[model samples]
Target: MIIKPMIRSNMCINAHPIGCAKETENQINYVIAQKAKRGTKTLAEGGKAPRTVLVLGCSTGYGLASRITAAFEYGADTIGVSFEKQPTQVKGGTPGWYNNMAFDKAAEKAGLKTKTFNADAYSDECRAEVIKQLKDWGAKADLVIYSLASPVRTDPDTKVMYRSVIKPINQVYSGASLDMMTGKITQASTQPAEGDEIPNTVKVMGGEDWERWIKQLSEADVLADGCRTLAYSYIGPSLSHPIYRDGTIGEAKKDLEKRAHNIDAALKAKGGAAYVSVNKGLITRSSSVIPIITQYLGVLFKIMKKQGTHEGCIEQMERLFAERLYTADGKVPVDSENRIRMDDWEMDPKVQDEVNKVMPAVTEENVNELVDLDGIRHDFLIINGFDVDGVDYNKEVTDMSKIEY
Candidate 1:
């Protein structure tokens, strides 16, 4: 029986379970199509195959993509650890849990091994439980991917609290067009991050948590030889520097980059490596809300897609696994900034140069022609399978209660 829709702020916060399931299948199909285009020679090569992978922040975005890559691209047995769970009515909604269920169903259909731990990744108790579960399965992970984004975290020891904020570094106010109704950009102001916010932002969003996860795994002896760990970052065009790179969040990313190096050093004796891959921005539930970013991404996506070079989160992850991280050569590529450079192509000077030429002129009147705003918006809705084509959005979606990790 389809469930009756619940009203929330005059908008539908509910998702159709069947639609979500179909969306997951679509993503799997996309991976297969992309692989075919890239050729099988570039795919992850394995004789016995790594049986276990631990993917933190596997609820959405890069983390979810990483899990799919491990299961589909490498045929690894996977365990996804995330705080997201099926939302009870009192607790609001379960966007991540439903997505996970869809992923699990698709993976099972493909004969891939999968499990999920719907618990907080930052909590010691949760980590202990995951380690115990792995030990019970008589398995250790050959790969770990940390891709968490949270606004606040309490130190496990100090119990001190930290909150993340995104602001610009300079005293500048920028204009952007925002959808007043949806709070999305149709196209207003992006301000600079305050100087003092930089260090604090880094402390919160950077690599400290990533390193902690690795350390815990190593201490538990759950890390396999030649294991690799990756965390995702973003480096957009210069136009967003004041609001992103030089902003509070940028400071956090810098801290994250530094944390990767520290993690690498700690793992050296164990023949493990830690890396931070700079990833391209796409329309995600998180990225869409950031000021000015929506407009810029809309423009960028349109330009890149037309040139036959655009990539969504899944595409980027597939390439990261096939072309860079797991390549046969054993060499990880880095850019001039001394970090992994997957996002470099997205921010190519020529591309950004062209984007800049049109950004200032992109008003609502000419937005469709100048940018892929509709595509960007559609991707956002598609994240939850709300606005996808061929899906019956009007169908009563009553299975929310059954979605589980």
Candidate 2:
């Protein structure tokens, strides 16, 4: 059947298999092109790069981008962990499932070693399987990228599941939310967190799972000497602080940042380090439904594109590896808080000033002129395998399980 995007409440609920495969291939191609342009080399060429890498939540968004950059750009053998449903005879699976298929197929054709597991990353069993795989290969992980984003996480110790919420703390949040499909603006409000909601959000989205993964890997001796680890975070403009940076999710991120220090110390004892990378905002599956993020991004994208400094997931990850993680002098440059700031360009004073100026004047009548409504809509659809280039959407997809990647 000819597939189209099924969008509701600014979220796309369905994905096209062929479109997903093509999009993954696009990211892989971008990384390969960058590798050649930047003159990056493998460890055999006497250049600095990770030999063995592990990526948790390695199937979608930034996680998948990180995996692609590591394997295609740096020639690292990668072990990926993500939970995604498989396609059935009647229906296609999640976008991440198709993306993983494309990635694995591309990696095999390129002769890059990879092992992808479809299991919960928040579980101890998943960690054990990764460790066992590393031991079997007689390889140790030198780079571990933690980029998992889930609304729910079950405690590995108690088996109790916790869900995360995006509510603000101590104050009500009211902002204009953009409907990417209809371009209709509506007033969206969320009450402050109450009744153990903050703690529960922390339990689901915080750093405990990240620390657990590191400790288990270190204990199993699956970590290489000078091993480096990173967890992705975001801190947008202060205009979004009330709903994002200072919200319940923000509290959870604080825990994530604080635990980075503990993990850093533990890894530092063995010539390793841990860091939290604050990444740029993009139209992701999770961010699309946020109170003000969609509207904010529409304005931000307009100014950034005009300035010629716009970046997507693939662009950000490539720059992170080429500039920040691996430098010529072996010194990783970071902010005063020891965190890599990939959002530097997005938060530039000039860019933010334009965004701040344009946002307040935006209305339904002039939204297209004031904001990148077309750009935002395209990005929203692209995340779920729609609006991608070089994909024949009119063609029938007979099999949901296969794609020519």
RMSD values for the candidates in order, in angstroms, are 3.5, 0.9
Q: Please give, for residues 150-187, the per-residue lDDT of candidate 2 as tens digits.
A: 99999999999999999999999999989978889999
Q: At residue 91, what lDDT does model 1 achieve?
A: 41
lDDT of 1: 0.73
lDDT of 1 by residue, 214-294 (tens): 889889998888788888888788877777887788878888888888888887787878888898888765566666777
Clash count in backbone of candidate 2:
0
Candidate 2 at 369: error in angstroms?
1.0
- Model 2, 120: alpha-carbon shift in Å? 0.5
| Model 1, TM vs. native | 0.88
